[model samples]
Target: FQISYAGATDSSVQFIFYQPIIHGWRETDFFPCSASCGGGYQLTSAECFDLRSNQVVADQYCQYYPENIKPKPKLQECNLDPCPASDGYKHIMPYDLYHPLPRWESTPWTACSSSCGGGIQSRSISCVEEDIQGHISPVEEWKCMYIPKMPVFQPCNIFDCPKWLAQEWSPCTMTCGQGFTYRVVLCIDHRGMHTGGCSPKIKPHIKEECIVSTPCYKTKEKLPKEAKLPWYKQAQEPEEGTAVSEEPSFILEGWSTCSVTCGVGRQVRLVKCQVVLSFSQSVADLPIDECEGPKPVSQRVCYSGPCSGEATEYTPEKAELLYGSLQEFDEQYDWEYEDFTECSESCGGG
Candidate 1:
């Protein structure tokens, strides 16, 4: 420094910095242990102290101690006190152990909403701290970051719902002629109990049309005692009906009314035997080879009671028009048969 009053020449001055204790950087002390008791480690660092400035200085200035090793001690074991059993050390006697750090804690999950169908359930969670004698207190979520995090939510029961059920089908309603059959059907729940929860649109059918293919029996006393009959007609005893067959069969049509409404008038009838198709019961004419049968009498006497006096022409509204029916029959056949009837007694074998 230069010492002078106003306008005087600056007086020269010099200054030098030095350390009173010229010790180099060394590991002289260790930091506090991570835990006050139980096994833990304490860390030591390499640093130099300057007594002249009463402060820590950079290690680059500490070059006097060439004997000191370059790498310094890092950490060492620290055992301040024995750990209690509640501190996760079961070998030691149990005591009112407490943790200084916060950690995660959770409660058991709740029961599922349903046993079969899908449902949801949950449990309680918390970040907590424990005081003396294992007393716990809630803490912030961030405090438990050192420990593994727990999931607060999870999926519970997951499966399908109840479905419709059915029982074995019942026998057909008829032994002969067309009829129907039925069976039991129900909606069953997961617990094997009945319920109406099933959908109506998807419900199974319980009633259906079923064919008892065997024709019904009728006595023809007019038939000759020596007349040969088909195996189906010969039996007066019941026979087991069968399912509808792919083959066609001979069927009989009902007789027509008398041609004239009064006295001594002639009446005409067509062949009663026609073919009934399988599955669809449509009546049609088929070749004799397909469905041979004992043909029923086409023409018969009409006695709608004895003819009344006067015998006035009474046009019943429901009377069938014979002209159209005969015309249709003419288109199909010549109204004469010499070969199809299974009965040998039939004239011309038909």
Candidate 2:
């Protein structure tokens, strides 16, 4: 938000821009249960609310802001206790015209047996009879034999769960001392798969900052590229219209992994310069210097849950046993990168 004002001493005018404001989601109170006895479900939903306006607003106001995420609706269980029996004696009564017809029923489906490669989920199938009071109870399967029954089990995940796989790390960026090394990482599912289901919080680091213990004494320097040059020494004038964009912006990539595998850590992203042509609106990469305006934030705090209580840390040798070893390096001795041990998040996101 910005406002322009005229100067009292002159005709010149200037504008002042306001800083962005923070927004959040607000959940409504849960509604009453669907049932007074047996199992029941109650629900509550989220709404975008404005503190200053004191009113509930459209979802676009909350959703459009990156930091303001709409939370999942809350679901609660109520009236769980089973209803008491009507009579102390148990007897088989003859079927009558007033009774409701018995029907086949099934319980909720259980979790998938496997996350990928085709798995099965099952539910308990039974015949249920409803009494005059509208109470339902399990009855003998033969009671509903005339009706077609639902399958007791169903197939799930014709192999859709994708796993994160990391390529072997490259040789250290520096030959004689610690620098940087990186590798490729990807998310892959089976025969048919959809894009963008992978969790961003647990993604592994493509580049590791520290490695290679070999020591060296080296200094790198740069020479000036511009100075007054004679006509004979100077090259031909550069071609015209080489620059494509009138305005420059930043291209922010996905965030890198946390600095720590467990507990609290710092995560950062890559912000590169980009060019957007005014005429065509086509975007292209540009050198960092070309970009204008305050840079977008590329770093934030992250949590990968708490560290395992184990006394020892997981090492590369242990990872090799599980994931299989990559090619060996020629260096006589160097400390390998530690593997992500184990952590359990109590809540979602950092």
Candidate with the greatest TM-score versus the true structure: 1
Worst 10-residue lDDT window for candidate 2 reads: 322-331
Candidate 1, 266-300: lDDT as tens digits: 24544433333332344435444433344333333
What is each predicted model's overall lDDT from 0 to 1? 0.52, 0.56
Per-residue lDDT over 1-350 for candidate 2, one digit per residue giving the tens place of the 0 to 100 score: 65667777767666777656444588778768644655544667678877677688787777767777766656556665554566342332332332356678888999999877799999998889776567999976645654568998899977656766666875554454545455555664564332345576887877576545767553432222342221123222222233533334456676688788885555666566655533234554554544444443454445566688845554434434422211122123222434442223312311
Q: Give candidate 2's whole-model lDDT.
A: 0.56
Question: Residue 325, candidate 1: how far off, in angstroms?
Answer: 42
List ranges where model 2 is wrong by over 4 Å.
1-98, 163-183, 189-350
Question: How close to the true structure is residue 328 of candidate 2, measured as C-alpha lDDT?
Answer: 25
Clashes of each: 1, 0
Q: Total backbone clashes of model 1? A: 1
